[model samples]
Target: MRAAEHRRELVTLAYPVYAELLSGVTAGIINMVWVARLGGHAVAAVAVATNVENLLLGVIFVAGSGTTVLVARARGAGDRAATHSAVRGGWALWAVITPVVAVGGYLCREPLARLLLGGGEGGSLRLATGYFAIALPGIAVLFATNVVDGILKGMGDTRTPMRLAAVANGSILVLDPLLILGCGLGVRGAAIATVLGRSAALACGLVVLHRGRASRRPAEAAECGIGSLGADARRTARTGLPMSADFVVRMAGALALVAVVARIGVDEVAAYGIATKAMYVATMAFYSVRQAAAIHTAHLLGAGHDQRRAVGRQALLLSGALGLSALLILLTAAPWIMRAFGSQGEVAEAGALYLRCLGPYLVLLACFIALGGVFEGSGASPALARVTLCGTTLQLALAYGLSGWGLPGICLAMASSMALQCAAVGRMYLRTGRMGRTERPPATGSEADRPWIPAAAASDETH
Candidate 1:
């Protein structure tokens, strides 16, 4: 495909993903808004609960992301049996994982809340436990919905997932006030509202999945022979585990960075928190492009094309533009952005400075993150995950050493770490280009031993 065509397809896939991501963030903010009226303890309880939810999201990525790449590849190769196996793999993994998380989490709700709340014996601890009691079980709904979204995205339908997110968030928006205040259910009500909203969306998503062509199986597909459930589950887990590790490492690194920021002083820590939230707006856009690139690259590869170089180039271009735009916006409007978040005085000044200093780091992070999708689609994610782990460890050490210089020093550490990561991934990208030219695609069943050729591509390479 032409460069312009590749860029256009990426934009088509990315924008809806961006919207869906932004909406989820927006809903979280609004959900907090409703909880804030209940007082500081209430706010604290819900905040900690939601943070746990974010971590749990990384766990479920095993099913969701793995299914997406596999299904997209199968679709491109027109392998109906492979597609069926991929979908089953996702659900099987979900089934095996959900009970452990949901039921176990509920049983340990009090202990979990105490751990999260620093073992405090207070109203906040009690509220948090109550919130967990409901939210933990409700996680089953969230996991299933993510699988549905993954399947839809793999089938080249990003808009539907965007709409489904809107449906869920909209329902939460309507339900929050009614349950939290009107019914006097407190933090538990917020948890209930979230679960109920997600449940509604899950119902709609299942209906959509049933009607979609991707979920259908004809007699011909039966002839193609579906893999056993254990085999399918293992395949999906192997494909997705690296991606999930990458996400969890990043999340853990971000959390640890907060502790490093705290060493600078409480005001700086507050500033760091608000600034990071604002940064999410841009980061989400970069991730959307990454997702789009992964989908497009996997699809093309499944169709017997080695176009990773082309897709990675476009992903970098798109994400670079977004990063540059965000940098300029932050530089020009840092103070205003801080004010919008309700910070003032020393806090606002510190946050504005932090935002202004974030330009280089954001740009490098955009490129690194975007390139990662190409690796993921081509079955090179294990290497990508290793780089991420090393980079994150380096970042924390650098940040700890540089805390003396305040947020700007911290920004420098982040930028330095991300630059090294980008160089690493850039070398990998170049190697793939060399391999594409010098080597034939790997044989079928040999993908496990290869680095760049995916299983689907291995089967379809002759095309």
Candidate 2:
């Protein structure tokens, strides 16, 4: 498709995907309100435990994304063998990562919670641990389900995932309170409910991926098929590491907020929470579109086409559109949304102010997201990680140094860091024709196994 045609296609493909994001966030918002009704500790426990879980899951996502990039483009190139290779690799990836995390999470739940809740006397740590313990094992099911979903999406099948997401969200919304206070399970019950909901969603997503999406023929997906385990593992590891690192950068970046925003008090914290919810609703949709572009770019490059420029342009345009919409929502409807989560009036007001302050943030973040996709699609997962780390590190430094000024200063720090990150990644893409480390350098004795990094090709031609 031409650039303009591609853009329109992207918008169409993204609508249902975007709805998935919106509904998912809506479910979370409802869950939060219900949990909040149980009192501050219950609410706080959910927040803290969820953050830790996100951090762990983010790490896992790095591997998952690698699986998506590898599988999507292979499928796009019309190579049935390579397509299934990527899928198998993704499953293997979860097999490796999930168990380690579950066991570690259950073991370290106390210390992790203490660190997250800051050893407060309010029983926040215990509550967080209770939540984490209940949620840990269920994570395995979540990971497996998502791997199948990601593989399907890599092939341009988003409708099934969205449908699954709706069911998942509905289940969570209904189950969150019922299991928590209803079963006298307390905060642990809420966590249990989320896991169950996720499992249900996973089941739905898996069915669609295996049955509704890929070719029903067993022979087509030979590349990612079960037998090519060695090849899949090698490629997935090389790519997944950097992607996971990017996740690390994000989690670390979020921690910077604790130092910067903590001084503004719990109300400010709650407000930021709500604002973040809104931000995710807007940005995740944009991200879904970006993922589609990544798949497109990978396929094009794999076909020896110079469509990278077009991919870059479309990604930026969509990101900009989504970011602007987020800003508008934040500025106009912050107060209205803030009214629902009323632990304190001041907190709600502060959150409303936060929504306004962070409005322009979406623009800066758009640059970061699109660039990262460019990097990932081009087989430069490590480069994307480096870029993210650069910006996140800057945020941490400024957050600590500027905390004396207040929460708004932290917001400024975040914005500045984003701008710098975008500039850095964009420059790298323009000059290198791929992000740094476009793909992992081949391991010794495995020169034939090298990933398809475009910049490496351009360089070889020059020599």
Candidate 3:
């Protein structure tokens, strides 16, 4: 693709993804708004439950992301059999995982509730259990929707999934009040509303998958060695596991960093939490770009191009612009942002300080994350995952060692680690550019399932 074309394609794919992510945030906010009418305990209940749901999302990525990469690659290769196998693999993985979570979770609702709320018979626990009783069972709908989204994105149509999210979350915004207050189901009503909205969306998604452009390929085309269902599942797992681990590792590291912040002071911890939450606005934008890059990279690779260098450059440019914009916003508006959150005194001061110091980290993170997408799409995610683990560990150690300086120290630690990650990714990018289309050794089993290969590798040519 030309420079202009790359920009256009990346933007075309990215904006809808950004909208989809924002709608998800909107759904949570809508739920919170309605639940707040019940009381603080009810709000607390929904919050904790949603946090757990977020973690569960990571589990589902094993299927969703795996399917996306495989399908995109297949589409690029014009391999209908591989596309079919990829779709089946995603569904197969979902089927195996959903029952364990949805069924087992319902049976242990009370214990799970207790675990999140620290074991109490308080109103929060009661409300949490009530919410889980409905939400846990509804995990099937969520899983199916996610799989559908993955399949569509793999087909190179991100717009439909974005529209689906808007439709489902939009319904939740409309139904939450009617179910929660008007229908008198309380917290359980919120869960029901969410499930109903998502189920409706899922139904729409299935229809699209059956009739959409993604499914239009002729069935009698060459198989291109698409694996069997079980093999595909394992391959999908292998391809996606590193991406999943990267997410989980980041989450775990963030949580651990909170503990490190606690060593400073309670006020600092509160400020750190609030500042981090605020940072998500910027971070999610970076991630949106990352997803766009991944999808585009995979699609191009499947189509027999190795434009990782070009893709990486464009991704960095896009994310770097956004990151710089965020830096300016945070720098100029940190005080007002803290006040907007109703923070006061030391909390506001500390948060502003952290935000001001956050610029370097955000810029580095945007570059790293966006570049990491190329690695993911090209089946080099294990390396990215290793870098993430190393960076997270280094950040925590530095944070703990620099706790005396409070939030500023934490920001410095984060920036330092991110810088290291960027450096590592840069080296890999240079190597890929130099190597061009050199053939790699043939992979076995799950690794062979990866659809991406250098031109030589795919063409059966020896190096």
Candidate 4:
């Protein structure tokens, strides 16, 4: 594709994803708002519960992200069998994974709450367990919705997922106050509202899955003769494991960094938490760019196009612009942003300082994340995952060592790690260029092992 075409496609694919991600964050914020009214214990409970949910999300990414790339590639190849196989694999993996997290989580809710709360005082622990009682079991809805969104996005239908997110989160916004305070259920009420909203949205999503454009394709009519459930689940797991690892590793690093910051003082830890949430607005845009690049890259590769260089360049450009924009906003608006979040005193001061120091990290992180999508789409995610793991380790080590400098030091650690990650990825990109016209092989062995040749050649081979 030409540069202009590539730019346009990236923008088209990215905005809706940004909206979808934003809606999720917005839903959490809304939940927090309602829960906040219940007292510090209630807020703490919801926060811990939400963090657990975020971890659970990483677990589901195995299916959600795997299905997306596989389906996109197959769709581009116009391979009906491969497309069907990809979908089946995603569902298979989901079927196996959901019950484990949901049921197991419910069974372990109290211990889990204690662990997250660090065996804290009474009210918060009980409240957190209360939330988890419903939320853990309701994770099935969250897991299923993610798979549905992934499938739609893989089929190049980002808008529908965006709409579904709006529907789901919007329902939460409406239900939170009514359920939490009006119904007098408190923390459990918040959990119930969240589950009901997500369940309704999941139902709508399933309807779309059955009757929407992606599901109605002529390719859907073709028999894929996909293998047994176990085989398909394994295939999906293999494709998605690196992506899931990358996410979980990063989350683990963030959580660990919080502990590092905690050594500084309660003020710094509080500041870090609030600042991170504020930063999600900017970071989510970067991730959306990454997702778009991945989808676009996978589609083009499956269609026998080797345009990784162009795709990488465009992704960097888009995400870089976003990063720079975020930098400028944070630099100029740090104090105001902290104030907007209702922070004050040392917490406000520390948060503002952190925001100002966050610019370099955000820019480097955006570039690395966007380029990593190219690797992911082309099945090089293991390499990217390794990079992430190393970077995260470096970040935590640096954060602990630099705790003397407070939140700014933590920000410096983040920037330093991201810079290393960017350098490594840059070297890989240049190496690919030096390797010349040879296609970077797909990351896995299934049908993707088939070499990409001309459409005519592929058809001839099939015949």
Q: Which regions of candidate 4 are displaced past 4 Å?
A: 216-222, 433-463
Q: List the residue pairs that clash in candidate 1.
A: none
Candidate 2 C-alpha lDDT tens digits along 353-416: 7777786667888767866676777777676777788888888888677666656666777888
Runs in model 3 with CA error above 4 Å? 216-227, 433-452, 456-463
Q: Superposing all C-alpha atoms, what RMSD in Å does each candidate have to the true structure?
A: 3.4, 4.2, 3.8, 4.0
For model 1, how does the per-residue alpha-carbon lDDT over 1-463 read when each residue is reduced to its tens digit? 7788889999999999999999879778877999999999999999999889999999999999888888887777776767777888899999999999999999999999999889979999999999999999999999999999988888888999899899999999999999999999989999999999999999999999877555864565467656467877887788788899999999999999999999999999999999999999999999999999888877887776777888888899999999999999999999999999999999999999999999999999999989988877766788889999999999999999999999999999999999999999899897784423211122233342243443334322222
Supply candidate 3's per-residue lDDT for 413.
Answer: 92
* Ranking of all predicted structures according to TM-score, beginning with the best and ending with the worst: 1, 4, 3, 2
Identify the candidate with maximal lDDT: 1
Candidate 3 TM-score to native: 0.92
- My TM-score estimates for the predictions, one after another, are 0.94, 0.86, 0.92, 0.93
Task: Highest TM-score: give the candidate number.
Answer: 1
Q: Per-residue lDDT for 351-382 in model 3, tens only? A: 99999999999999999999988887877888
Number of backbone collisions per candidate: 0, 6, 1, 0
Tens-place lDDT digits, model 4, residues 1-463: 6776787899999999999999999888899999999999999899999999998899999999988988888778777667767787888888899999999999999999999888966999999998999999999999999999989999999999999988888898889999999999999989998999999889999988778556545464444444455666776787788899999999888888888999999998889989999999999999999899989988887787767778888899999999999999999999999999999998999999999999999999999999988887877788889999999999999988888988888889899989999999888876643321212223334644344442323232111
lDDT of each: 0.87, 0.70, 0.84, 0.85
